[model samples]
Target: MNSESSAQIDVTKPHPARRYDYWLGGSVNYEADRASADAVAEAFPTIHLAALENRSFLRRVVTYLAAEAGISQFLDIGAGLPTAGNVHEIAQDITPAARIVYVDNDPIVLAHARTLLDSSAQGATAYLDADVRDPERILTHPNLLATLDLSKPVALMLVAIVHFLTDDDHPHDLVRRLCDALPPGSYLVMSHGTDDYLDIEDRAETSAANQRSGVPFQLRSTAEFSRFFTGFDLVAPGITSVTTWRPEGWRPHPRKEAVSMLGGVGRIGTRAVG
Candidate 1:
């Protein structure tokens, strides 16, 4: 869609994209988003930490993909509002010609695409109003394929978004279908929410609150998160806390909260699933 058309996107419902933007301290969120986020936050106090760790994971994994894995094209599925150090920015910094396609069903994301998420002239960026479950639509979307070459190795990032898919959404099968379409040497980067560290009552309360918001939030176990990366070679460190995966030198702040999120990056190859 053109810039003018994209501006007509809905601003009413509490979109997950905008709620996430608010969590990241961005200004693109609406009141409804703030309300929804406030409710979720009140129930799950660690959400803020999860958001930070999740974003950090995105940055670290993208850097690894571009610098070490030598990938130039990125397909960021369910990509929320473009924030600091987005996929293209990180990748293009390492390889100037890196191409990226940011996919989301939220219209608000598209409205801000050309401005908030501009790409370097040497590289390319595009947005699509597509759902995560619709792999074929996303893969075949003209705008997506225009910027990304499916034939070549690409990093398919689904960080912090799969949990938005409830059981009926069949998130596991959806991920597998998307991976099956990619060529060997491609990669899948995922970070999912979990309740492993929470008490039973807290977990139940948090789950119920998320359900009330019209968006079903599914928190999986470490093993469950790993299942999404099946049929691929897990990168060094495998699935672990975001801080533990390729941790930088700076010591992390003392934990005021507990962490229940699990994340990791995996590589695809011609051999059997890793």
Candidate 2:
């Protein structure tokens, strides 16, 4: 990590990426992150399971894109800590020449980006330290341009990241801007936290806990989450809980309510909404 970026990292405050890393049983988090994660876990005991389920969804989606959809390029935003089954790892495994660009605002992610940059000799990887709110910056980054060709089909990955953006953030516009930059035949892959499956009381409790945890979280309903795919055509098994989204061969899949995350893939058609 460069001294400037290292100086920007405040271990005293809890960040969403670090807290998620904590829940995923990664050792790259600090006490603040662990505390925030534990607070949410107190409200939703299955959060750790949700994290694992979301990770599995990412892998399956990437496999479908690379192996089936013939997508050789990927732009994964809100990329958290590097772990097993990274985008480059999964895509390059299927298409040896697959190229990936990972974007994240977290300084900690930047620090560990070296791990993300280790691509298969036939493939390539690049990481950009940028926020999701600034779609233009991510879209125009020189590294991204060099790694992915916007004219070709690319997978725009927004997994488990948009929930951090509140209504005030205009998350829809942000997503649209990114999608608009990709041409027809591109794909949008996303997984988001939702309270749709939760009972009234549990929903209130979970919302309260997330509020008190000091991390910005906005859990949407199924309809609200589905609106994000307005311009594209959803793939089969549209907008279901992450655990149930093509959980191929995984035995005893957990109940959808247990995971509480909605995931889907959408193919950008020629007439896709702007």
Candidate 3:
């Protein structure tokens, strides 16, 4: 990136994506992000495990999308700093013809997304610098258009990103707008953090810390989070914690509920399109 663009980044403040990278043991974060992430870990010692389980959920969902659902294209919005088992990796690993379009607005994330652009000989990859609040922009972006065919089913991946948006952001509408543009057979694969499982005080403290960090975090209830799939058909083991979402015998963390994030994969209703 040019110096002018780089100057816009304040390394002194933590970014949600970078902080997540820190928790996932990625080397792309700065001191500010690490410090904030450490504080979150101290307050909720299971956060790192939550991050791991969240990524694991992404892997399992992507595999199902590619191998079972026969989805060959993915629109992974708010794709944080790349790590192992990324959407494209898991998708293309199953169907080498899979194509992926990753969207994010973080400078560091944009810089690192180049790695996400690498794909198998039979597939393709693309990156777009866009924000989650404006799903229209992503849906219309030239890169996304070039990489994915909206006329066909796409696995829209929103893993662990919606929590960053507050109620005022109308995240539900934003998500709906994105899904509305997809064909009827498309799927929505998402996970969101919640305060439902935490003590009131613990939830308050975590919310306060995140607020002070200049990053908004909203922990919703399971019912509220499930609203994201209102018009779709949920996969089996629907709307459960990421740890228990089709466990597939992969339990990488203890006290799974401490992760406190719910995930589900929902296929857009094919009957609705006619």
Please state the error at residue 114 of candidate 1 in Å.
0.9
Query: Candidate 3 residues 1-274, lDDT tens each?
Result: 1111222667898898999998898898999898888777766888988998898888888888888889999999989888887887888888898999988888888777667887888999988888899887888888888889899999899999999999999999888888888998899999999888888889878877666666778889999998899878999999888878777764454554589898999999864321
Q: Name the regions of candidate 1 deviating beyond 4 angstroms.
A: 1-8, 253-257, 271-274
RMSD (CA, Å), each prediction: 2.2, 1.8, 2.8
lDDT score at residue 205, model 1, on the 0-100 scale: 87
Error of 1 at 249 (Å): 2.1
- Winner on TM-score between 1 and 2 is 2
lDDT at residue 193 of model 3 (Cα atoms): 91
Q: lDDT tens digits, residues 1-274, model 1?
A: 2232443666667888899899889999888888888889888877777788778878989999999989998989888887888888899899999998888888878777775358887888888878998899888888876777888988889988998898889988899888888889999898888877778899888888897665568988888888888778999999887767887768673242355677788898885353
Best candidate according to TM-score: 2
Tens digits of lDDT, candidate 2, 1-274 = 1112433789998999888898888999999898888889988999999999999999999998998899999999999999888998999988999999999888999889998998888888998889999998899888898888898999999999999999999999999888988999999999999998899999988998998788999999999998889978998888899988888884789998889999999999996665
The candidates, ranked best first by TM-score, are 2, 3, 1
**Number of clashes found in candidate 3:** 0
- The per-residue C-alpha lDDT of model 2 at residue 262 equals 95
TM-score of 2: 0.97
Model number with the top lDDT: 2
Model 3 regions lying over 4 Å from their true place: 1-8, 250-253, 271-274
